[model samples]
Target: MIKILAVGDVIGRPGRQALQVGLAKVRESMTPDFIIVNGENSAGGFGITRKIFDDFINSCGVDCVTMGNHWMDKRDIYEFRDHPQIVLPANMSNVDDPAKGLRILESKSGVRVAVMNLLGKVFMKGENSCPFAMVDKMLDLTPSYVKVRLLDVHAEATSEKQGLGQYLAGRLSAVYGTHSHVPTADERILKNHTGFVTDLGMTGPYDSVIGIDPDSAVRRLRTGEKRNFEPAKNDLWFYGMLFEINEDSGACTGVHRLRFPAKDS
Candidate 1:
């Protein structure tokens, strides 16, 4: 069995710290073959930085980092976007973007896994190309040696995420959603043996509104003012999913949602 760990959006410093704590426990209990984290919000809840990316890969034991709409929020990303361990949203119509949308990485056990990042259009910013079509192009581009595949659908609407999961059920090993920052209860294997989830949630403070400071988020919602949002520091937790795949068939046999709260919490 090839076990893969797919983590949700890392909010900020708190989220990164929570990941370190939670992943330590996971490693002690049952180490996964490959670890994938959504680092789109890793840097101050905006975008990832080189330091955070290194921490995730070197310190946190993450094999790959997936990004979302905020892929360009931090200017430093441009310097290291070409890193093979990072993947950005593929549907960006801008062909000039230096970062790639898909990557095929080899696990320590020699299992080839293809990871793809995609953005959603519904209730999202930017002119995103058709996710359905883009996914097809990505699958076609995947090399034959890489059978196991996972897609991080960084989307807002559950419908769009579900649709994409269904659209590529058998073709991909797993399809999981992100960006909502609230974990969904639904997790199941599709009829075609692919694992699916609406959202993997956020690895940050659960006490606040989606990892933002409660006061600031509430004030913005109540006053309709564009208030500066900061990552909350209380009640930190790590949200993610675990998938057990059959190496020969590239089918997901087991899907489990993971939520590990801070030990002190």
Candidate 2:
């Protein structure tokens, strides 16, 4: 079996710290062959810095990282088309942007795994391409050696994620949603052995509003003020998923959630 860990969105410093603190234990307990994390919000709850991206892979034990709509929040990433650890959002127009959406990694056991990053058209801020068509093109681009396919479907609409999962049920090994900080209750293997979920939640402070300081978030909600944001340092929690894959066929055998309970006294 080839086990793979798929982590949810990382929001700011709190998320990074939570992953840093708990990932080693997760790796030891699960013994996964590969680890993937979504780092769209890894920097300051908006976009990732190159250093934070590197830290995600080096210190957090992540094999590959995906992004969401906030992938372009940092102006520095305007030239980040060549970053090694990131799988750029696929739905973004390639006519002007210098980023691509898919990547393939070879596990130590020789299993060729394909990870795809895609943005949805519902409730997203930026202009996006046709997800269905892009996914079709991605399927065609997969080399023969690739046995497993995983998708990080970054979207806000649960209907969209569910529809996509149904569409690609028998073809892809797994499909997961990101962007939402709260995880969905649905985590299970499809009839065709494909794993699916609405969202993977987040790795960050559990006590705050999506990893921000509670006072600031509440103030923003109540008074509509944009105060200087800081990642909440207290009461951390980590969220993600783990999958057991068939080594030969690359189909998922089992799927489970990886949750680090909130530290509250």
Q: Could you give me the TM-score of model 2 versus the true structure? A: 0.92
lDDT digits (tens) for residues 116-142 of candidate 2: 888878887667777888888888888
lDDT (CA) for every model shown? 0.89, 0.81
Which candidate has the top score in lDDT?
Answer: 1
Report the lDDT tens digits of candidate 1 across residue range 1-265. 9999999999999998889998987888887999999999999999988999998998878999999988888999999988999998989654223237889998878999999999888999778789888888888888877889999999999999999999988889999999999999999999758999999999988999999999999999999875778998999988999999987788999999888786444
lDDT of 1 at 250: 89
* Candidate 2 residue runs with Cα over 4 Å from true position: 94-99, 262-265
Model 1 lowest lDDT segment of ten: 92-101
- Give each model a TM-score: 0.96, 0.92
Q: Where does candidate 2 have its weakest 10-residue lDDT segment?
A: 91-100
RMSD each, Å: 1.6, 2.3
